[model samples]
Target: MKRSFENPLIGDKVYFTKYATEPGSPASIIDVELKPGGGNGLHYHKTFAEHFECLEGELSIQVGKEILRLLPGETATAPAGSLHRFFNASAQPNRFRVTIDPGHPGFENTLKIAYGLASDGHVNKAGMPKKLWHMGTIILLSDTNLPGFFSLIQRPLAWMARRAMADGRFKRELEPYTR
Candidate 1:
């Protein structure tokens, strides 16, 4: 099964072609379209690595302080625990295939929540959640680790996230996104 999600605020789209739950699929794969000058900020994951293969246009993957520039068919990887991000500096949209090694359904769900938040104007200019609790919930559910000083608040946010999950806030907020 394939599902497409869009972040209207950033003009980004992710088409989920394969997920862990799918038969014979070992990883979560997405065909992503990124708007010019748009992409995510630096973040790292502890559980999974990400592979990016440029399918069209130019793609730049930044791992640590090094940037790997790619043309069509080129690929780069950010291993687990590496701080990284991807961006499109061109004037047009760029398409790339991203595979999350070892697959993470929670990560996929976080994408859904993000897009839903953007559609509802609940995200900031950079497409991050405007609400601290919401951001914390996403951080917990998605296994996303923010860098540097931002990491300090992770614990408090996680605490709020646990409460949200137990109080049904998680399900209520995710319900709109899943459909």
Candidate 2:
């Protein structure tokens, strides 16, 4: 696996610095850098929690209904099943460390796929996949759930993803990024 991943479309860079190799350590840890005005949409994970610790600049994270602005040395946690998002609203870049407890391999692969898609111009300007099946595949693998009414379509999206997997399309797309 690559040590670093970059989403040029969204101005986000993530460096995988730690993994669940130790007996008693973080499942996954990453150093993240978000360019000014760069951020991700609100979404929730079905498993694991993300502990965001700001390292430089300002990191704004919205966890559930509250928006927390963290500075250097501050930390905020987005527990599993909580709708959350993060961004860099500052004029300069924002650097933070995200620790995922009980790490998930699918989630890690999701980032690689998404970033690869962006680099290949398979995603839109907003960094979303251009194809529905691709979107479904990503959502299925990432454990990411959309908010509100969009959540209702999770089943259908998952179905599409499963179909792709069954047809070997998923393997074709994922193999380049993962294994």
Candidate 3:
């Protein structure tokens, strides 16, 4: 098991961070502060649910068909496969944290890839590309954790994740990892 600072959004006044606990557990914590009109683009997790808690200002979270406005000390949860998005509608960046259940391998590695792409000047302020989608399938097929048929699916699955990350719908905040 490895632990370190990886997520791009970590700092005192700008953004927060995400951390993975233990190994093989599907969970992560994301801390963030969104500036006025700043928010996370719409996305969904097919593997685990995401819960959020507002630490400062007001947070506007959209879970499926319902949009919720959570104030300080408030919290909300979005179940797996639910379309969810969050933002700050105030003058200051809204501060909050997200916990994603059911972790995955190279969680930090994925962020590094996205950040590397962004640093090359390919990403927008929102961090999302023009398009992006599910790339988890790629990891599953090529993990090498299992042999036989599972290994056979690696190439195709990785191809799909690459394509989705290149042109998926939601953009993730990314940064190179450092300890």
Q: Give the TM-scores of the predictions, in the order they appear.
A: 0.94, 0.93, 0.59
Query: Mind giving the per-residue lDDT tens digits that candidate 2 earns over 60-175?
Result: 99998899999999999999999999998889999999988877777777877888898889999878799888889888987899997888987898999899899998888765
Instruction: Name the lDDT value of residue 129 in candidate 2.
Output: 91
Please provide, for model 1 over 73-178, each residue's C-alpha lDDT reduced to its tens digit, 9 standing for 90 to 100.
9999999999999999888789999999989988888888888899999988877788877888788877899998988999999998888889998788755685
The deviation in Å at residue 7 for candidate 2 is 1.2
User: Candidate 3 residues 33-136, lDDT tens each?
Assistant: 56677665565656677788999889989987799999989999988777778877777767787776654435445544444444455546655433332334
Clashing pairs in 2: none
The total of clashing pairs for model 3 equals 15
lDDT of 3 at 154: 48
- Compute the lDDT of residue 108 as modeled in candidate 1: 85
Output the number of the TM-score-best candidate. 1
Give the poorly placed runs of model 3, Cα more than 4 Å off. Answer: 1-18, 21-26, 105-108, 124-179
Q: Is candidate 1 or candidate 2 better by lDDT?
A: 1
Off by over 4 Å in 2: 21-26
Alpha-carbon lDDT of model 3: 0.56
Candidate with the larger TM-score of 1 and 3: 1
For all predictions, the C-alpha RMSD in Å is: 1.4, 1.5, 9.3
